[model samples]
Target: MIQMPLQDMIKKITDGAGISEQEVNDKIKQKLEQLSGLISKEGAAHIISNELGVKLIPETTGRLEIKNILMGMRDVEVVGKVTHNFGIREFKTDNREGKVANIIIADETGSIRIVCWGDQADKTSDLNPGDIVKISSGYVRSNQERNEIHMNDRSVLEKNPEGITIDIGPSAASRKKIEELAENEGNAELLGTIVQVFDPKFFEVCPECNKRAKPTESGAYSCPQHGDVTPNYSYLLTAYLDDGTGNIQAVFFRNLVESLLGKNAEEILSYKDNPSAIEQIKTDLLGNMIKVTGRVNKNTMFERLEFVVQSVDPNPNPDDELKLLEKEKQSVEAQAVTEEVQ
Candidate 1:
């Protein structure tokens, strides 16, 4: 039996497979150590990644698969167009006394914060808010609040000269057939990366029907469709979402606004600098799997289909569904009591 160092075993495993070195050294240390006892010293020295079936990827690494990227991974390169730039922040490192720049980048898959060091930050300057980028050799890292990617010395990025490509994965937009969506009664799974969120403005429209709001003489707005009604100005986000099947504009109604910001739609739309609000809205919708229940509105001018959302539930979070069930139960019980009284 040959003797092998644990470090060597980690290297061998990560090198053969697309797994990250951090996975063998940090996350799977205990598992590797335990497996070490079972194998001969020589065998342990050459732990194969294929033995694990799947690679241990880092968090926030952009990849070909948006779902996998959102969930976190070892390393991945994703291509996306920057929908908005929220500026960059500088943070100082205690040990090195050096600063790093942090910026958020979004693809049709989702949005993740990228940390740039030294020349990388400067190189990214040419990449503006709407330009496309191919982030290469990126690794995922999770913080206390969320998962993000580090674009430090180890990472590399390239601009996409061919324009932003529209290929998400199998679970992404291509699967949502418009014909099927029209026939389905309940929620339809929709895939898209949100590109924009329009800020709300003062307008009058029918409360029931969201037609173009009209202005009247009393320094107020009125909806002509609904006669003699008070004007309501609500913050509703208008997002450009690309689902590969086609790029369409969508209105994420009210609940999605509350779920994302812990605030109502009215609050989100009223902000003066709407770019920040747009960023938050994008984070909540992009890359995240969603089941959008709404009717399709065909845009004659844009030749695109829009989902005027009735309800949106993040597929990754099951608690929202559970809450809906609980509410339904309470409603049914209350209705039963009312019927008995009648």
Candidate 2:
């Protein structure tokens, strides 16, 4: 990671704040010495930048490819095409409710998910599939076995910006059957019929980080990352899906649930308080065929194989697949008859 020179950073801060260069340098030196063994020179420079209200982006480092990104990197720039965009969901903290959006962007090298929070989430409302974008000053972190980029207040999001063109290769997901699903199979597409829609459950989430908020002994909700949150509601749906050969439990989050039930979390939560409304939603979804794309994992809590659905297509055509199966079955029956006669 390239860093701005101390002299150049000091000059910028002094000029921007109408302060003497000597005073700025002394302040930076004092901060560095105070935390002598704790932070590096680059970290000290970052502290100085924040203190002086200066945003730092290395001019010489250039844009990083998605393949080169590592966890804990900051102020990185990358350009890619939006391959998948998820619905914005709301969460509440002690202060108020906030929204978050997530999307998967891909370049020729690979793909990574970008999480946008608060007003930044609204900025992604106009983004569409295949749209080129440039993200600047973004933060990178790894979560749930995958690396993701986060756009915060300090980040910049540009759509179809000049001097950037990413070759977004095929984004189609590989199809797998329920019987063939293995633990940690990454992302895959599956076709199956919903055997049952279990009663949906709602949980409280922290508004700041969008993590689940656990209840405290004092009758308040708290998040590990963001303490003392007011708690916002989010829905989770578990259903059994069968693809002829086998069956597996599938879990659906807010976006997938809305897509499948045609209702958002708020609407779903309203129904949760009414038994008839909840049953109606179950009645409308059970026994329906769907094409699901998601990550396969082992549910350690339940000791069963589970699919965490990313998206759901409630209207999938299974006629062609059934025809092929019938044709193969007929061929096998004819061979069996010939063998019996012989």
How displaced is residue 92 in candidate 2, in Å? 36
Q: TM-score of every model?
A: 0.33, 0.46
Question: Local distance difference test, per candidate?
Answer: 0.56, 0.81
Question: What TM-score would candidate 2 get against the native?
Answer: 0.46
**Number of colliding residue pairs in model 1:** 7
Per-residue lDDT tens digits of candidate 2, residues 199-273?
888889999888999999999999998899998888889999998989998999988888888886678888667
C-alpha positional error of residue 146 in candidate 2 after TM-score superposition, expressed in Å: 21
lDDT for model 1, on a 0 to 1 scale?
A: 0.56
How close is each model in CA RMSD to the real structure?
17.9, 19.0
> Which pairs of residues collide in model 2?
none
